[model samples]
Target: MPERKILAIIQARMGSTRLPGKILADIGGKPMLCRVVERARRAACLDGVLVATTTRAEDDAVEWLCRERGYVCTRGHPTDVLDRYYQAARQAAADVVVRLTADCPMIDPAVIDQVVGAFLAADPPVDFAANRLPDDRTFPIGLDTEVCTFAALARAWSEAGEPYQREHVMPYLYEAPGRFRIFLVRSARDHSHLRWTVDTAEDLELARRIYAHFGGRDDFTWGEVLALVEREPSLAAINAHVQQRTLGDQA
Candidate 1:
């Protein structure tokens, strides 16, 4: 609606070191990737949402799921995810690209709109904007959203040399301060300690519990989930000990 085509490209696959086949994992009554797409579609900022899987044989199921649901999906290198994003953006003719991961089934549409709105509202416009980053992050883990221009994404895809940069996607945009115009969107309340992402067994357990609490409804906002976790402290305790993984640790 802003004259530019905004597409949220979700990088997904059947392989995950921590939780293999997690894209298709059940969180509530539906597959987690489907849940992510459904929630993303609710965001008013996005023109469309596309899933970018890999060419690996294992990811055929991912393509199948996308097809069965009538979602547009693109296949690319398994590890070079930056390339996958660039190709997906180019193919979709996306002027603005929002990057999301499939592991986050509870991704908030409000949060997506918030970040995308900020990205679009920037006076001079930033090369990239994100709700969470390495040093400054106040939002919960699973609600993370990163928005960048297709040109910015293409630059990163062409220039990023580090494997971690490629695998994590968007690191090249923010890893260097002056190299690209970067903006940070922080929440008023610091909820960085909250781990809502599904990357481990504990994280998955917590996701199922949260979804179950909402009666398998994907319309719940991040605020409601925060309140639910506050009222029921036991729910937060479920994954309190699970440390959020960092690219530095793996790199």
Candidate 2:
């Protein structure tokens, strides 16, 4: 039998609805994509990290940056992100694929490990597992991580017909009850109210402020960030009003 390999594919593009070209937005002094990739690579569970971007002309910059930084990358359909992920995973021969987004600059490596550990250790073997999904998300939005066997991903790629399912990826596995066994990694407390993802102008500002608080350090733990927010409620309040768009809204 072949040794299992887990690959983290950080989906990125220059076309964010609220903030176009935000993938390269500077946080502290580094590009936000670099920060996300750096943090994700720290997770011991991931055998490799690949940046999945689109082939559109505008996204050429994304591919170029990956080359310059020596981060492995694969390109595919722009709107059909499920295809992008599927192709990327197939090229890497990834046995297991962990889905991440470039918008989450504050993504934690510990959380990635915890989620990957659960998926790896599942006795019955879940088809999918994620830190946050369709609903009841306890972890902050930025820490979102989705893990699925490449088989499950391949199935979704072939059968998922809805645009949202194709664009968001992994929804087909979890949206219908009992379609795929799923493991959800929830927080001990309800920190779901927090918004750490950089989806809008305010979100980018908060990310910049948080990184600045750590003096441009990229290795700060989520606990340290929580403590920082606790001490400075104003910081958490930066993008507190920013409403997260639902999959329905996104479609």
Candidate 3:
């Protein structure tokens, strides 16, 4: 087990610019939010998983989802995602925070464990760790893990300015590079070609296609997703519409 209590904070909201109520959207016979929780729960290194959603009454449905399933849920400022994460960490008394998004339902638990393991194994000790996406074996889309210390997150909350900073926390640490001990993990296979996020209609269609392939199995692995997509190349083309976030891109 890891020394620091690893808390997975999944930032979610009912309103999405591209796909409204995407979190509440259905995939595999369950809400997208629940699927995200199920994947996070599969991580062996995580001590717990909490869905950090906004306090808006529109999101009351999300809270009810948690209550209905007996999963942990938290409420905070919707746009100010940084504060939301901070409050969630406080609630869980977490020392290490793993930032996940509710949009990423097919996020691999094994990938999360590998990153957490790397954080614990660093000799000089790392303030944070992440996978450099679009480089190594194509990490499945929608699955991003940022493992950082509570101390670092506090500093980010205090020092980080600008709306983008508040909107998408912790870019300062990764972009600053040498300021913190940062390490990147490469995927063993070319799984990065897979897209598993729900950002747009295209993305959702792809997810629906994937669900159809897997018959909405909750325990579906990353490999299984890739294999299905391989058999049906058209499924991968669903999200060929939107461009992915670039290194210089702001939230």
Best by TM-score: 2
lDDT of 1: 0.91
Clashing pairs in 3: 138-191, 138-192, 139-192
User: Over the full model, what C-alpha lDDT does candidate 3 score relative to the true structure?
Assistant: 0.81
Worst window of 10 by summed lDDT in candidate 2: 242-251
**Candidate numbers sorted by TM-score from highest down:** 2, 1, 3
Candidate 3 regions with alpha-carbon error over 4 angstroms: 133-137, 189-193, 245-251
Badly placed stretches (over 4 Å) of model 2 are none
Write the residue-wise lDDT of candidate 2 on 66-125 in tens digits: 999999988999999999999999999999999999999999999999999999888888
TM per candidate:
0.97, 0.98, 0.92
Candidate 1 — worst ten consecutive residues by lDDT sum? Answer: 242-251
- Candidate 2 vs candidate 3: which has greater TM-score? 2
In terms of lDDT, the best-performing candidate is: 2
Query: Candidate 3 — worst ten consecutive residues by lDDT sum?
Result: 131-140
Badly placed stretches (over 4 Å) of model 1 are: 248-251
